[model samples]
Target: MTYAEILSHIYALGRFGIKPGLERISRLMAALGDPQKNLPAVHVVGTNGKGSTASFLSSILTTAGYRTGLFTSPHLISFTERIRIDGREISEDSVVHLAQRVMAAAPPDTTFFEMITALAVLYFAEEGVDIAVFEAGMGGSRDATNILDGLLTVITPVALDHVEYLGADVPEIAAEKASICKPGTPLVSARQVSSAGEAIAAKAAGIGATLYRCGSDFDACWKAGKLEYRGVGVTLHEVVPGLHGRYQSCNAATALAAAEVLSGIGFPLERAALVGGVENASWPGRMEMFDGEPRILLDGAHNPAGAEALADALAEIPRGKLVMVIGVMADKDREPLLSALLPLADLVVTVSPALERALPAAELAESCRRQGAAVEIGGSVAGGVERARELAGADGLVVICGSLFTVGEARGHLLSRPFEAFRG
Candidate 1:
């Protein structure tokens, strides 16, 4: 199949729509010879920061001279962004070939995520990667990526998102995510709410996995104007993270701890690699910036916790009036999301991505109005961003956010890039 045709097939699989089980994926992987078995990997799971942590860990492993594969989701612009080796996205031709191979072995009940996850593992094994880093699509235990036997599991701050599918609150969500902690595996976790921490601790203890808490076992912070990281027996100063936002410091610290664990477990990772990796790691659509008049910041902060982080980051940057282009999905907690950013925005240009799941522009605008925000309906993601830039002017700032789909559309618009046909 050609690239477009294969992408269509992959997207068509979405009709299965998030079946919450491992049986289908297991059957598909078994049909494809179980390529995920024994692959040295680091599995990253959380409500937020999963991509950033996986990016940092992948870069660190790559910097240490290991051929690394990274599998992430919700591509910002192109489908190729979902799979990468050594920081390079999989080529279009490779994607087409791999999609074909994966589809052939896929079960009739296979979901889009399962097929994609299978393709990633198959590609990594075929390419002979020394290690791979996978970001869980959702809860860890039944996530498609959970098929891999990762040497370490990293849980970045769990929060209340995916409630219907995962659970109702922090403890329930944390337990679902923490289920990725395999027996005897080293599980590194970021600082969490007490409930979340306790849930994760219980899971680790129950499974006999050694738990490493961020504050108790290691930490990262700006001390006397320098970034410092204290890991499990390894201390590094001047640990600069390539990503923006204060929340990223915690994510980086978690990755650093995981790296330290990998090093101890015969990965041969060194200080130089650890420093270089965090310094160079990059995750797009999360506090990503584009230069020009009225510089634009792109962040996919669909949840309240993520919105709060974006708001905090915006507070630190010096700018004139803040014009925000916001688009969120229909199922998200819109009130809490808007509450975090509405007060900070001088103007909110509401838009909807070209997606079936997106909340309509009028609905989003109504929500913004209810919050007493200065809101206007911009119809589409591109229109909203363009309108926001005009409102922001050269001296002001424009932030595009609310969902990855929104960021992806704005990014594609600003860069004049074509998007892939598939999105899930």
Candidate 2:
């Protein structure tokens, strides 16, 4: 099969529509010879920071002379972005070959995410990767990727997310993520609510997994123009992560803890590799800035927690007035997301992203209005970004956020140089 044919076949799997259980993926992987079991893995799961943490860990392992495979979800630009080896995205040939193999193994009905997860494992194993970092696509336990055994399990900050699937309360959500822990696999986690932390600790103990809790077993501090990370047999100073947002310090810390645990398991990562990875790793569509006057900031703040982080980041910039161009998925917690962002905006330009699941521009405008922000509707993401730039004048800030799809659209606009060039 050709690359285009592979994509078409995988896209056709979307007809199954997001099966939230591991039975189908487990069966599919078994038929494919359980490729996931042949490779060592670091499983990263949480409501937020999983992608950044996974990227950091993968980069560190690669710098330490290990062949690393990184798997993430909800690609910003292309499907290939979901899988990578040593920072290079999966090639067309690799995608085609793997898709053909997986299609042969899968049942007549399979979800898109399941096929992709199986492909990632097969590709990583075939490439002989020394270590693979897998990010959970959604709630753990039932998540397709959780079917694999992990040498080190890292959980970033957990919050209220995926209420429809995971549960409305923090403890219920924490329990779902904790299901990824396996016996003899050391579990590392950030400090969470007391109830949530207890639930995770109990799960780890039940499975004979040593629990390494942040703030107790490991910690990170951001101060004096540096990020200080300290954990068992690991210490770093003045570390600067490539990603923005103060919350990244915690993500870096979680990665460090995972690295330390992996070292104990004989992976043996050097401190230099750890430092280099934190400083050099990059993940797009999270507080990504473009080069131009009336600077454009693109963030994928699709959930309430993410929106709050975006709001915090915006507070640090000294703009005359902030003009925001926003779009969001229809199924998201739109009210909470808009409430978090609208307070920081001087004016809001709502637009529809180029995705079938996008909330309509008029609906987004209504949400903004309800949040007490001056709002207008744009026909498309590009139009919204242009309008935001025009309203921000020469020295103001124009932020485009609310969804990864929105950020992707903004990136396409920026790359095409659709806006008028500015002279400083």
User: Using Cα atoms with residue i matched to residue i, what is each candidate's TM-score against the true structure?
Assistant: 0.96, 0.93
Residue 174 lDDT (model 1) = 97
Query: What are the per-residue Cα lDDT tens digits for candidate 2 across 1-424?
Result: 7776777767767777767998889999999998888789888888888888898889889889999999998777667888999999999788988888899999777789888989999999999999899998775788888878888888888888777888788888888888887787789998787888988898888888899998899899887757999887778899988888787888888888888888879799888999998888888888788757798888889888888989987877677778999898897778988889898988999999876788999998988887789998986988989888899888889999888888877887878733211100
Residue runs of model 2 more than 4 Å from their true location after superposition: 163-168, 416-424
Q: How accurate locally is residue 58 in candidate 1, as Cα lDDT from 0 to 100?
A: 92
Taken over the whole model, the C-alpha lDDT of each candidate is 0.89, 0.84
What is the clash tally of candidate 1?
A: 0
**Model 2 Cα RMSD, Å?**
4.2
